[model samples]
Target: MAEVHRVEEKTFEFEVPVVIVGAGAAGLVAALAAREAGADVLVIERDSVPRGSTALSAGLIPAPGTRFQKAAGIEDSPGLFARDILAKAHDEPDGDQVALVTREIGPAIEWLADNHGLAFSVIDDFTYPGHSARRMHGLPQRSGEELIDALRQAAEAAGIEILCDAHVTDLWADATGRVLGLGLVRPDGSTDEVGCGELILACNGYGGNKALVAEHVPSLSDALYFGHEGNQGDAILWGEALGAASRHLGGHQGHGSVAHPAGILISWATVTEGGFQVNLNGERFSNEAKGYSEQAAEVLRQPEGLAYTVFDERIAGIVRQFEDFRRAEAMGIILTADTPEALAERMNVPSGMLAETFAEVSRLKAEGARDGFGRDFSGVADLAAPYHAVRVTGALFHTQGGLVVDDAARVLTRDGAVLPNLYATGGAACGVSGKDASGYLSGNGLLTAVALGRLAGQAAGRRVAIPASA
Candidate 1:
């Protein structure tokens, strides 16, 4: 671990109505909602606000039933969303946290679009394979930075105080084992204790810290992280030290076919549906019509656990229209050659096998066989010369595990006891999607982050600041 500069002993005393750890999507939402409910909220972050994974993500807000849904003529309900989420949670997930996310996702998404001025379009639910509903909500800005900026702006306008570069090293519990405050190590090598009426943990996942990754998520200990670099799982560690248990510790979505080398995330919409993906052997593997989650697992099944996308000048033009092209090129999956045989050689595959693979693809395209990809692959197939290949591989997204919380977003311990005054939401809490889907559910992360964050904020406000006392 890098030695972060800690501030000196400073007793910064404030009657903080709520202390929020981590200013990512979940934390930001919690802070904003809590403040709007008339609580003096403070958000302590390890990094500058608007710089966490939430800031770096594609700003796709997945609200099931909103004005946007009506505008797009899509049918959905909170109940349906909950059913899909619960189905996934049944497979190796924390049941309580999953339930919380499902119960509140619709309302949370509505809150963002309604209260936060988030411009979004309700298309079919972002379809990970196995999803029954077309439930993905896409943002006009299409970047996590926009969402972060909007959330932070809302929080600031509501008179919330955001402390940046303050790493939360430990949780401050009362004598009765209730969380009261936090131990903050600032950037200047100084230490300060900030008191709070309630604490909300939203510090995100442990993908960035190798040691923590091994300690928690053993499945992907060596897995590459495609999210922000600041998600080090501090909240999880602190919660564990204070006798809080976690779920899905070694479990997360292995996002399929990210833009390699560029470290940017591209929706599976583009790769599985838009681009041509192949295995390391320079041959097409699974049916491209499957969901990205299923495609990601098949790709990992390769000898090197990676795949590549091969396209011609025609597909290249399509890829160029998107801004994530740089990332595609960096991952070594996107390469160009003069002919099919040469392209195969560049990827170190059997030349004859490559030729046969392309021939089979051409035959399949001509036949117009349904591959179950819906309409996303309507125009794909049938490519010409100037071939290109993009190395597609799986990457660890948010962990679907952490401190368990109920539908109200209250943290629950191993023995089913509610940890009073301590609430958790977002990636810091366990994910709602479980084994029901092959990969992470498309919009569940954002959904739970906003929904559970709101629930926690509201509950924390009621618990910490009583109306009678006020």
Candidate 2:
């Protein structure tokens, strides 16, 4: 057995059935489920505030076969959802894992709604790319902050203790790879120890860590990272130290239409609702329908790493239901014009070229012609009068890769052996989006977070009793 280091300082030590790191979507949901399964759970967060990348998201979760989908008269199944994911991630490394998440996502959402009293409604206005069914669900406010708030409320009501500003510096595990507990650095510069029967790493990914970005996802190293700074990859480091295998290290989610200077998301609904991105030359460079994550690289390659999202009043109206778009509009970030020429002038692009681009889009829609950039305009209508535009740039939202795990959310070793008493979910675990940004189907992040989190929590809760030291 490896020698265990003992802390001599007069601080504090506590024991629980499960000790979770990070207080984001994953940790909170895990705590709820574990407590439901009769385990004593505690959550530790590095930040004083609990918000992480999940709060910065649109809070969309894709769950097929949900009660909301059935009530909306949409026929769907986990098999169909798995097919959509596999089709998008054409050579996905872990098809079984993708299928596992798909199977559990619906029940996870139902559990949140029924057991926890969290409310969600389907996003029926527009369908996100790569999903055959309209199954994206969100809070009434359609914001991640709202979802996090709901989860936090549910956790608190369940008596789950969440300690913020407590940074976990180390995991104490025996030589057999059984996690014993964690070392925490308190806000007052004091050190403490927490002993638990199980540990769940939910601290998110390494998108904010420049060195990790360069090492695993070099192509996106230069792009602006919009994820929370707290996602410094503590889970990856600790998992690796315990010989946990990692997968899909290059996979990430990127947003292509973050409003430049204004620093707010323009909502992909603009592009999905017949809007298009143009470079400084006022030319369409790529298919706008490829989805935000896939089109991020193309947007980054534009001149000065900037582009403009051009849409019409019809498109704007269709997307304005989203709070992010509404917020952007209220902030006066969305520029409006009566003609393509005026819009181009407002955007500082070539007026004639912009007009020509608009004409081409109209011609394609009229003649049923395939776009030169490989976009299918059959489903999209031409832009009418009263144009809208938002100057935009691409950004890495979060990394989708981390510790490898099985269907139970149990972290695994390089040789495919399970790490006893340790689990991971959310950005700390490998996602189902293959190994790059292009394979990220919408809502994969939160789906994995909630589904795997619930599974990990239940599994941990049922296995061990609270330590007598508590």
Candidate 3:
């Protein structure tokens, strides 16, 4: 056995049936499931509880074909959801993991509502970019905090031990490469070791770890400006130490840029509002009527990977019409100017071109186009000035690519063999992100995280342990 270092101040060991490395959606759900299976669960989070990627997110949970949908007269199934996700995967996602998520999503949603006090309001037939149907459900808190709150309550009531600010620095195993436990660093910088029957890594991606970001996704070397502060990719590295292989290490799931002050992601809202996105040259780029992800990609292709959304005084009404817009903009998502020329000047785009584009949009509307930026643009309210513009660039929420796993959420090696006692879920696992070619389905992340977490949690909990000497 490797030398186990003991903590001086507290020389104690707590053995649990399972040790979960992250406290985000995946880790918490895993803990919940493990406890349900009668396992003593220890959840070690790098940050305070409910303080990771999920907390910073808009809590859009997408699980197709539920009581919400059935009651609303919408017909769907896990098979249809799976098919749509696979189609979106476009051959890039791990086929097995995708299948697993589709299978377990319904149960996961049920679990959340039934056990975790997660109250959801279903938007009847509301559809995102890549999804075929409007099956996405928004959480009550409308933020990741709500989901975390529910998960935390359930886990606590289940007697799960949660260690916040306790970072697991390494994995501990026997000489035979049989997994044993983890080496954790407490918040005080002192390290301690905890042994467990199984270790679950739900520590999220390396969006904030610029070094890791540069190492994995070099394309965004300098572009990795924002993400959860604690997302240092410890989970991936710890898995590697245990001989686990990971994919899409540096892959980026781009988010639409949040505005300057509020900096809340606003891709969806921007697209929904009749906003015109102008490049640095003041030229309209992309099909504005398209999804936010597509718009974000278009923005990232520009100079400095930045653009501006120009709108007029009517933006106030539009903002009122769409709560997402108001929330995002009120959170510093919108950059307003009193005049079109001033807005153009502030955004550094050509004033003449912006004026011309605005005029063209008006002309197109007059000509019977439905909306601006290649939509019908007909009969829509023209953008009357008191114009405003907000700077936008492609931001990233999380990467979808990760360690390939089977339908059971078992992590697989490059040769396709499963890593013994290993499983993965959440953004840390490979997914069908860009499968849609246009973009991924909105709320896909949460959907997959909760579903796969439950699946992996149950599977890991049920896994029969091999004797240490065997």
Clashes of each: 30, 0, 17
TM-score of each: 0.83, 0.96, 0.83
lDDT of 1 by residue, 1-470 (tens): 32122233324465586999888889988987887677888898887555687765666656566666777677777667666665655545555545556556666777766887766665542344445656666565556776788788877777788999888776556544466566678788998877777889887877788787677555556656767677777767766665676776755656666655555665555444345566766666676545554455566677687777666766555435334564456555566888778988888878787888787666656776544434243445577777776566767666656777776777777777877778888878877665323536667677778888898898887766676467
What would the TM-score be for candidate 2 when compared with the true structure? 0.96
Global CA lDDT of candidate 3, please?
Answer: 0.68
Candidate 3 lDDT over 70-159, as tens digits, reads 878888887787777766556565666666676677778877788777787665623555666667775654566666777788888888
lDDT of 2 by residue, 1-470 (tens): 11234333322367777899989999999999899989989999988878888889988899999999988988889999999998887768588898899999999999999999989889887889999999999888788988998999999999999999898887677777887777888779997888888899888999989999999888778998888987888898888888999998899999899999777877887888788899989999999888899777888999998999999999888777678888998898899999999999999999999999999988888887788778888867778889999999899999998899998999999999999889999999999888898889989899899999999999888787554464
Best by TM-score: 2
| Candidate 1 accuracy as lDDT | 0.68
What's the lDDT for all of these models? Answer: 0.68, 0.88, 0.68
